[model samples]
Structures are given as C-alpha cells and as structure tokens.
Target: MRQHLWMICASLALVTASSAMADNFGMAGCGLGSMVLQSNGKEQIFVGTTNGTSASQTFGITSGTSNCKDDAATVAAMYISVNQEALKRDIARGNGESISGLASILNCSDSDALGTSLQRNFGGIFQNTISDSKEVAVQIRQSVYSDTTLASSCKAI
Candidate 1:
C-alpha cells in the first residue's frame, strides 16, 4: 500500500511538472528573451536576465511585439490623457481635429461618427466637474467600447 501511494504521488508530480512546462511564457513573461530562448524551464534564468539587462520587455509591451500585445483601450486612454482639453471641446461640439486624431489613433474608420457619438455622451464622460484626465480617459474608453458604431468601426476598441 505504501509503494502504491508513492507511485500515485510520483504520477501527480509528473503531471504538475508537465502542466507547468505547457505554459507559453517562462518566469520572465513574454519578451524578446522568451521569444529567443523558447523554454519555460531553467532557461528562464537567462530569459529573465536578458529582459532585465536589455529592457526589451518594456519595449515589447509598449510596441506590441515579442509575443506581448498592447490593449487598444489602454492606448486610447493614454491619448485621451494627453489631449484632454482639446478632446473635451471636440467631443462636446461633435467635430474637431483632436477628435479626428483620436479616431485615427484608435484605428476608427469614420472620425465623424466617433465625434458625434462622444458629443451625445459628453455628460456621462465629464460627469459635471471631473477634472482628472485619467478618469476622463477611462470614461471615453468605456463610451467608445460600449457604442455599437464606434466599437465596430474602431479596431482598438
């Protein structure tokens, strides 16, 4: 009975080990090192060291390369944060260069439609007197993501 129990424990250990090996990224996460090394085992040390030494992981996360992809909503939020004032005016009026620029950044086909949609939802986005750009950006992202026309037209949504 003891021998049988030991065998069962060993089998479970093997299963756990194999499952861990099946993971896509190693201890370093997705980066140039992980892409080049191609191992989720001891090679992770080298992968992690490479990522730390080169800072490629940050670049990979930002540029959507090396198995790391950037989120569209995050990109939109960043854009909104930078151009908060201009975007607010544009969104309020239902048209402007800032709105068109944001639409282009989000990969939306029709900037006009995006502007109009945001114009109608201005109250929800600004919320009376919210001055924080990041908060406003999040609201803009939510508005875009929830709109059928903007969401469908915007690739990043």
Candidate 2:
C-alpha cells in the first residue's frame, strides 16, 4: 500500500511538471514572453523581451474592436519610439530618473510605463546593467474599461 501511494504522488508530480513545461514551450512558440494580459474575459495583450545588450522593449494591446489589433501594434511601436526619446534625454542630461518619473512624462502608470521608459532612456536606465540585453516587454491583455490604450498609441508622435 505504501508503495502504491508513493507511486501515485510521483506520478502527480511528473504530470504537474510536464504541464508547466508544456505551457512554457507553447508561449515560446508564440514568440511572446511569459506574461499574458486578460481583461473583460478576453485576452488582449502579449509582451516579449529580446536578447541583447541594448535596452529594448515591446508590447501589444487588443481592444476587441476592428482596430483592436492595429491599436495594439501602434502601442508597441510608440513604446519603442518613446523609449528612444527618453534615452536621448537621459544621455544629454546625465541623470537617472525613477521609472515613475519616466512614466509620468509618458502619461502612463504601470508596467507598460516601465517598459516605455526603459526603451526611451536605455542609456541611463540600463547603463552598465547586465540585463541591458533583455528587453522589458509589455502587452495589453484587454481594454474594455478604458479606450486609453488605443488613444495612447494613436496619439504617439
């Protein structure tokens, strides 16, 4: 009886481990990171980090509308653009602003802001950092409560 019990526990452990591994593999195939965003009972965003020494960031947002996918794409693009701008400013000023400061300037308050600031101010935000090669990725999982996700990307210059 004890042997049977031990076998069952081991089997359960193996199953759990395999399930977790499968999930990770599935995410990798999608070219996305481990973070997934879901809101309004819908999946809305996915983010992935790139491997490199340069500070990089990427994110996607979906709103369940005709422009949902496009809006998400735009957000990702703007994130990169804003990050580059912030990096230039930090380099010129020689100051390291908190992630919050950078986010405030971008009018964002969340992990997305962190990713945006890192991209905009790579030089200062990730200077001499071992993780510079890894991109801080963000993804919009859902946008039901707020259309700001779409507006932010659309208004980005």
Worst 10 residues of 1 by lDDT: 15-24
lDDT (Cα, tens digit) per residue for candidate 1, span 60-116: 788866667645666677788889989889988999999998898899999999898
63: Cα error in model 1, Å? 7.4
Taking the tens digit of each residue's C-alpha lDDT, what string does model 2 give over 1-157?
9999998678656644544333232222222222221121222222223201111212222222211233333444455355644544553453445333434443453535344433444444344434221232121212211344433642321
lDDT of 1 at 95: 99
Clashing pairs in 1: none
Best by TM-score: 1
